[model samples]
Target: MPTQTRRSPPDGYYRTTVSSLAIALSAPAVAQETTGPDDGEVRAEQIADERRENPVDSIIVVGGRIDPYRIAGSADLIDSEDLRRFDYGDVNRVLRQVPGINTQEEDGFGLFPNIGLRGSPVERSSNITLMEDGVLIAPAPYAAPAAYYFPAIGRMQAVEVTKGAAAIRYGPRTIGGAVNLRSTDIPADGLAGYAFGQYGSRDYYQGQAWVGGDTDYVGALLETYQQGSDGFKTIDGLPDADTGFERQDYRGRLAVHTAPDAPVEARLEFVYGRSDLEANETYLGLADTDFAAEPYRRYAASQRDAFSGEHDQYRVTGSLAFSDGTRITATLYRNDFARSWSKLQDIDFDGDGSFDSISSVFVNPEDNAGALSILRGADSFEGAVRIRNNNRVYRSEGAQISLERPFEMGGARHNLAVSVRYHEDEEDRLQNEEFYSQIGGDLVFERQTDLGQQANREAKAKAIAFYIEDRIEIGALTLTPGLRYEGIDLTRLDYAGSDPDRSNGPTRVRQTNIDQWLPGLGATYELGDAILLAGVSRGFSPPGPGNPDARAEESWNYEAGVRYRSDKVQVSAIGFYNDYSNLLGNCTQSVGCSVGDIGDQFNGGAVTVKGLELSAAVEPRLSNSVSFPLSLAYTFTDAEFDSSFDSEFFGDVNEGDDLPYIARHQLYVEAGVNMGRAAATVGANYVSELRDNPGSGAVAENERIDDRIVFDIAGSYALTDKFSLFARVDNVLDNQYAVSRRPFGLRPGVPRRIVGGARVSF
Candidate 1:
């Protein structure tokens, strides 16, 4: 209906003071009985008061299929037993412990991070949309749409983070939401299983077996895993000299449960991957007063090489319920990817050096009058000086359709839906040449530059979207709202500087022009059961039309949050403010312009981000099935950088500042004590400190990265009901930090490690 102008205030003020104190303390809350004192553990204190009032039932496959207090926006869910007590091998560090996720490191942890939301444009925010079951695995418009490229979150069972409800059934970049990865079908009857273990040279295994009955169908799932380490922190003298990692994943699902006047019901699915790794360089480079006193330093020894090479994804989704209440659903998907990488750089010289050390400077190649010496029979010159390589390949095909029916107005009771989608993304890039060897660099004096360049880029982007949604129920009141429209087409071809022994000539690459429209909207209100949601959306990324005058980045998100559950506890709170515009970066050369465009600038003007979030959960009833769960989440951000324009050029940018990896405050706390066999959880996360990178400059600054606080402790034991046994201790007060920040100006994060495991189900 496109019409909104109600800036806040008007939605269950603590549910009208808890329904006027339940009719003014109705009979002392039922004679204040319910004795306490762990007496036979009253169902573990009612499941810890239902996990602290209600963090959505502490996890029940996202509360019997969504109704997050009637949903308006903002969502989160992570189960499958908190992914094995947080013993993750980077799903971007488990989405940085939630709360507006942010992680964009340039090195370490299997390299390639970079995922920021809310503050928008963290270098092309694909508007956020990543699905798994409903299909849609982001390969759109080329590069960077990662789900940690599969190591199979031990065979994922749950992970849904909507942030902004439905988003018109998932489209238009979700405006800044959508993260589905549900994979636990369970319908073909028979067979089910699992297995796990930990602490360094780690071990993990998974399994699933399904068989159908009554009118045949099929199913499949196989998983494999490996993690290694006889090292943990030390170069040269070695100890993690070159980190380790390994993975192999596969999945398949088939369905056909139709009959009873069949109206066609079909399904198909397949997924596969092979990930490999080697890492070391978790942000090392200090000197700002030693990173203001210890920020985890170790400088030099960068080596990470990944090879996923081939990945195949396919889907056919289905839905067709009818009998006049009409309904139709569809989805067809495809994804293919290729990856390659190499990095080998080592250095650590500063006398007193001997972490198993040595150094050299010049040897052979010549000294015939260019005067040079320091080849002390040389020591640490491990060749292959510098090499940054990447070979990419991607392919995609898409299809989508959705429909629903039912109507009635005035007297109210409507429910309508619509959706459409079409997609295409093909990209190729190859750049190689850094087989270093320069004892003399074929030179006479000392003037040579070759920041190694030999590029070859290709692109083809396409997009089309459509959406519509409505839901209105009378009585206690329920109103849902939605809308979406999107269209984009971009292409690129730079090939860097098509080498012909370039002399600064053929360096003209630009292309871009094709962006139709983008839109979004949302709403929700229930009141009776305590629900209130809000939304406003618009998102875009457009650029790489092959550089054609690159300039396309937009954002608009305004949100409201509220959710309350009863039966013993669950609370939620959200507040957002996002408004950005044409923000892209890389305008090299001391913040000027025209100079290989540094990395390619953008960020012309305007930027704002306000935030507020709160979460609470409780479950108590210490008896029967024993339970005790607790959860707390809090977020507060005040991103900045407002007004702009002056031929851009960034640099100590003013008019507000802040915003460079973002961090105003973030927190997460958890407590656990379950006994449906055995369980234990202890969690902690607190982040704050980061700001600087307005084009680097300030007592020596550039992409600042220093701020720490991360703690984790886990435990599990089931041994029956399908097996289980796990353990974890990550950074467990190993302190020493820098969560993330490093673009060229290095300083990565991720240290302190320990893992243990055991899981088996059948």
Candidate 2:
């Protein structure tokens, strides 16, 4: 008999090892051979080799390579190989290849992504859980989930997305799903490092470098990524001004671990990161007529608009594994973020003591000719153009622990895990306004107001969560059942603008408490080279610090799918439906909401969203040294309201009105040819028309974003074992289309861009 090794059970959320039953059930086409006394050692060595090849996968959401096929729900992983093919810095472009995801483009650079999973709302990506290295990365996920800051994608090693029952394991916002970004990891043994640089159109440049090594008892890593562009949009009357942005990110990691053969294996790690960004961007967009004539032109009123931000993160993690197949992990993390955006907020060109939002001016330009003329720099105006300095600071800190154990009973194997977390976050706002006058097509400073004149408030939240999950295996069938509880306390304090110091105490204070229980179940059955999966889960998204009567978004989600995999081909098709009992909408400046309405939540009554996701991939050998690889993904969604209601954020609402900003159809396709040393790929993405407001029937001309199809091509060639050259062309056809119509006027998509780069490894 073989020296049977006691293999630890797979984690409920992350890293796991392949089981013999899974191998036998999923890969029936492969031949199985009898094992000798050394088979256990050989299996352990194979697992070690796989980890060496992709260390970053250990901290991702979908676990190891084989877990995607074995999990009883929909999951996808974009490994380093896939990311290197296109070298996309914009997350929007990277996520388009994955099914069941919806993205709304803003700024054309993905600086602030609006991503939705399945049929959840896509506003600032607040309806989903976002993480980096298995930890929450949102600045203030509970107090202010709106993503004003996003990690740099150029430095990431992998991206994972999980939906259905598995998503409940990582929550606060489980209505949509969870997206986790994996960063560079310390080498297992020898020293390793890589450097990359790229230069492209519009004076754009990107560079990344990292180095890491592990000794007998210690490991360390350091990395940096930098990118900038001169921008493509031209500012009216200011041709020399650069409407570009610059970003810099830095990270450092240290790890301490016991010997590989220690009785109680343990590891402790510390990580720190910092990032800064400066951009001459704005929320003011062009009028309809101006957009038709010149889509990439910026209005004169927005010439002085700019944004600056800084973020810092610190984290510590510890893991312990016992010889009895039980594992425990704990983590502590903190994040700090601050930003200030100066842009046009309101206009009163006639000096009538009444101010109108910038969005309203563009909606009725004919009626506001005086304001429109001043905005276009065609006429001089006195002091009445208000430019707001929206300054805010955020802080988030949390601690969590998880334990997993496996046992056998009644001829069945069971994996059980429990987790607990305590988190606190806050958002502080201290903003003011500055008056400007238009003189000779140039902005002239008129007057500046004291701090806190515009807004002075703080919102905070403290929450505790508990989760438990069990995975039971019987023959070729696997079942997963999970339950979670969340208790949250929210509070908001408002100060009078006149008393910036708050010496007289807060003018008003509001507080609320909420408790919820979420449950989910998933099952998977294996049948001869194919697997069938189904799941039903409760979805939830908590409301921010708003009206006491505000209700959290609640829904029941159901999904069923089938997957087939062979040596040369893999295919999957899943159908999902989300039934909402109480849908919620949030107002923010990015959505064209007025200053007074910002941070407000509204009830949307009943709603229903149903969608189908299809994906396929195939690779065929054409010759002895050549192969062709191809993949396609498509999604169809129907999202609409089932009851009549009215809200300031969504305007007038009626039954059957479709939700805004979500397209009806999306498709992506890619094909590549790979030789021994050279490779090339071409990809295309298509999105159907989108509506800007809630309404049924034919979309109004002003509220519609026409359908668009964009093509991209990339090629790479290896010159040596450690060096390679690559080039990419985005928007190969230069198709012009409107990406969005919000916060002001029309915004255009990225034009044709060409880039060339090189990479070196050591």
Winner by TM-score: 2
Give the TM-score of each candidate.
0.30, 0.92
Please give the range of 10 consecutive residues that has the lowest summed lDDT in model 2: 1-10
What is the C-alpha local distance difference test score of candidate 2?
0.83
CA shift at 153, candidate 1, in angstroms? 23
**TM-score of predicted structure 2:** 0.92
Over all chains combined, what TM-score does candidate 1 have?
0.30
Per-residue alpha-carbon lDDT of candidate 2 for residues 567-590, written as tens digits (9 for 90 to 100)? 888999999999999888878888
In candidate 1, what are the lDDT values of residues 1-762, reduced to their tens digit?
121221223244334434533443342223224323233134333333332232221111323344574455676777666665665655655665457655444433433444555554343234466666656665543323433243344455667676644443564454456566666553344555444545552222223333322234545555444444433333322334444334444455555545433444333434443444443333223333433454443333332323345567776666655433444567777787666554322222222322211111111113211111111111223332333354566777788766655444455555566666777776665545343322332101222223225456555666666666666666655566655655555545454444534344333333443433454555667676577778776655444444334455566778887788887788888798878765655342212233343234455566777888788888887797888888777778787777544544455576676656666777878788887777778788777666545432332333455566777777777777776677777667777655443322234355556666566655
